[model samples]
Target: MRLVTFNILHGRSLRDGQVDTGRLAEAIRRLDPDILALQEVDRAQERSHHADLTDVAAAAMGAVDQRFVPALAGTPGAAWVPAADPDDPGTAGYGVSLLSRHPATAWRVLRLPRIPFRVPRTGPHRWPQRLAPEEPRVAVAGRFATPEGPLTAVSTHLSFVPGWGQLQLLALRRALAAVDGPVVLLGDLNLRGRQPERLTGYRPLGRRPTMPAGRPDHQIDHILLRGELGPVRLVDNPEMELSDHRPLVVELGARRG
Candidate 1:
């Protein structure tokens, strides 16, 4: 089974600053991931032409099942509110999503704890700036009935602030512990290095840098596995200009009985 994690930057191309669902769909079709985890997904947002990005991606990839959990009620970098109505399609929001070709039997969304205190931003020269409010975060978990067995997959986008991201990671780990099958976690964690592995006890499946698609220097996006899912390897793709971050793809072999 193939798994892919990508931060689509709300389906906007960094090269042209355009949000074209057609282009985004074609990009996902080319990747052809069996399971896809996405961050920075927009739904009914004016910026992205009120497009349900997750739905578009799912249709494009021909996913059998999918789920989208909003972390916020409005667009990022703009005036936004908290997400309250899960059934309201007209409500604009930003969040993470999961798409799978395999049938999903169960699903859950875990809302992570946000920092109570405001975090101050730093200037380009590393000077302290005005305080900024912490955005709400969430994790979407899905239990898929794969040929190898049930696989629990999670998609999340954590805070970029130091210490706070770790707290979110810890919460995610605890929530995932409830699942009884092999777990595959995917997202643009924002935290660097081997911190995720150290925090969640999940081994990183891919090491290729994904951010700044033009010339990435950090492997912020990741696909991590908690239990053995056989010999997993990265799927190589030559072109990656759809979003700011390059998509990370991995193939999971049948589990050994």
Candidate 2:
């Protein structure tokens, strides 16, 4: 099947300094992915015209099933706020999303706690209180019933801080351990293309870099499969200059046992 992992940067297009839903829609149509994992998606941000990105994206791609998990919440018109409303995950400025053409059997949001530590006090920073709370992070996981069987798809955005992201990565690996079926992990891992030994249970598809879209010298965004699927192909949708990171497409077919 054709699966895609994209960091939309909240649907902001690099071609223009604006959040254009149409451009975002067009990109999905071109990719024609059966399953999609999106990062930096805005659920109710005023900057995005308060448009629900998951819904808009589903409609744009004619997807029937979709789920969104916000990492933190934001005010109606204020996308800058970093506060997360315990009452609602949708208000979060950032989130991860899963969209599929097939019906979803179940869905869940996996919240990953940050490592307890203080930011270096020597550098210029934002509000004083901002640095105290645990750096928020989350993963959106869902089970999609395909013709073959139930398949799990997970989407998440890891921390960028060194050592900190490693802890988050371990948390993600543990979360995946609970699933007992075929699975695919997709997201912006914030890992520079080096080696996979730091993490466990899966392997990356290819070695192409995806960050700084212009240069793309690192492969942070990734798609990992569980079973011994047949040969995997990595897709680079280079024409869609909608975000700082390039979108990745992975093709997987069943393998013989």
Candidate 3:
């Protein structure tokens, strides 16, 4: 099966500095993900032409089951409120989405911890030190009846703050304790390398640099496994025209005999 995690940057292509739905659809169609997790998705926003990006991705990949979880209600980088309803898709908000071809047996939406005020930090190519305010982060989860068996998957975007992301991850781990099976986490974690593995005790299924789509050096996007699965067949980041980060694709050998 192909599992993918992508930070779409709201479907705005850096190549042309515009939000093109057709471009976004084509990009998603290429991955052909059986399970897709997307961050920075916009819903009913003017910037993206009032497009329901989650619906677009579902259609592009032929996914019958999907959910959009908004961390904030309203427009991103502008007026908005911290969205508490995980199932709410009507509000104009930006957040994460999970789409799957298998019918979901259960669904969950979780709100992650975030820094309420601006914090100073050094960015890769950004200013030496810039105060940036982080929007509320959220996660969406679903349990599906796959040919392999019942699989549980969670997708989330964590805080970018130095130590805060780890804390948020820990909180998320606690939140997901009740899930019936080993969880596969897919998202732009913002925490790189063994950090996520060590914190969640979930091994990384695959990894590749995905930031700064033009020339990625740091791998912030990931697909992690909390329990046993088939050997990883392949892992790669496909170059795309949209978003600052490339999409991470991982192919697994099989479920079991």
Give the number of the best model, judged by TM-score. 3
Q: Give the per-residue lDDT digits (tens) of candidate 2, residues 58-114.
A: 998888898877776764223343435353644546678899998998887788867
Candidate lDDT values, in order: 0.86, 0.76, 0.88
Candidate 3 stretches greater than 4 Å from native: 86-88, 120-125, 128-133
Rank by TM-score (best first): 3, 1, 2
TM-score for each model: 0.93, 0.85, 0.94
Model 1 clash pairs are: none
Order of models, best lDDT first: 3, 1, 2
RMSD, each candidate, Å?
Answer: 2.1, 3.8, 2.1
Per-residue CA lDDT of candidate 3, range 75-194, in tens? 875688888753465678889999999999999888877787887756567775666567888889999888778899999999888898898899989998877776899999898778
* lDDT agreement of model 1 with the native: 0.86
Stronger candidate by TM-score (1 vs 2): 1
> In candidate 1, what are the lDDT values of residues 119-203, reduced to their tens digit?
8777768887778777888889999999888999999999988888899999999988877979999998888889999999999
